[model samples]
Target: MALFIFRSIPMNTYELDCPAVPFETVGKTVAQVVSRIEQRLRKAELEPEWVVAANWIDDANDSLHGLKADALWPVVVEGESRLCLSVAIGRSEGWLVQIDHVRLHKAGDGGHWSSVALLRIKTLTRTHAWAVAAAMSRLLEID
Candidate 1:
């Protein structure tokens, strides 16, 4: 029953021991998801800068077509293919902690906020990164 136990698995290899709200599908397009995430973050009392960046790149068309980068980064999730996000958090130590492999999931239903999967970022160990991940998770609800 120890926390911070790392496990290697197929679906969520880096899953973390955290609490998350129930899954809720809310959007159709990536734009909607970004907006929803932004709104959620704001409601959670997170600063706009903390949200970092958000964007979506179409892989089906096999071209660098439309992409948005600001608070929410977008990626195509087909079935079990998860999207990973790397976030950097500033700390009082005068260095940034990088959180890599934050997975995202696409909810079966797309209405306002696209369903996203949450993967525990193993590489992130710094207090700042951990705090950022927890706050962002609360805002994005990727659990």
Candidate 2:
């Protein structure tokens, strides 16, 4: 006879917020932030629902040129109830990374998807971007 061992582990969670702890998007716009995170996610195979690049301004060359200097990337987690992981992608000299949770559910039977709720934001840094990106990619991998 063969014996089998089972183990249980807690799911990892992430968050982000303003006055960012590990980083800040002081001069970055939403589009720029999203673009940066988009690249990171794609490289790590953790692509989010969608990514919006800045049309008006591609580079952070002029701080005053960019608009909507804040953005978030929505990632899906395997589960019911439409819960998803959201990262606040900020544009700055150093990238601003904030992780959090949000609920995306349909309004009614045919209504479009909408984010209903959110949890506290936990800020992180570019120094940890690759690590965080890898972990997130694993979490989202399909079996």
Candidate 3:
């Protein structure tokens, strides 16, 4: 005879906060900060299915340039289909992080889907990276 046992974990119980341990960001550039955010998200097991986008901006005068990074996750929330977290470092804007709700609509009988952004958090500092990762992780736990 063989004995078997199975364990079922509950869902939607993830904490949407940064880890209690301190995060070090001293002397780190914007790209490094973005890398940290990606690391945290992957450590929390939310990277496999997420979509990540990165854009680098530059001008001829070399006076305006920076990198923009965005991570998107598909969610099943009421009246919404997806969520995006974006971080950007612009020439004038030091560091900006935004969380937006993404809604998909059919494009005029063409069978194409268009996405619209519904802004959630307009601006957040680089230190909020861990929090953003946590939020994305929590979304995966939704049932």
In candidate 2, what are the lDDT values of residues 43-96, reduced to their tens digit? Answer: 644334344433234444422332223433234444433334444445433333
Compared with the true structure, model 2 gives a TM-score of: 0.27
What's the C-alpha lDDT at position 93 in model 1? 29
Model 3: residues with Cα > 4 Å off, grouped in runs: 1-17, 48-55, 58-143
**Model 3 — TM-score against the truth?**
0.32
Flag the better candidate by lDDT, 1 or 3. Answer: 3
Give one digit per residue, the lDDT tens place, for model 3 in 1-66. 999898985432223454444345344443454455556656754342223323333222211222
- Candidate 2 regions exceeding 4 Å error are 2-24, 52-143
lDDT of 3 at 25: 39
TM-score of each: 0.36, 0.27, 0.32
For model 3, the local distance difference test gives 0.40
Name the top lDDT candidate: 3
lDDT of 1 by residue, 31-103 (tens): 4444455565455443244332122333332122223332233343545433434445334322232222223
lDDT for each candidate structure? 0.37, 0.38, 0.40
Q: Number of clashing residue pairs in every model?
A: 21, 11, 0
lDDT of 3 at 18: 44
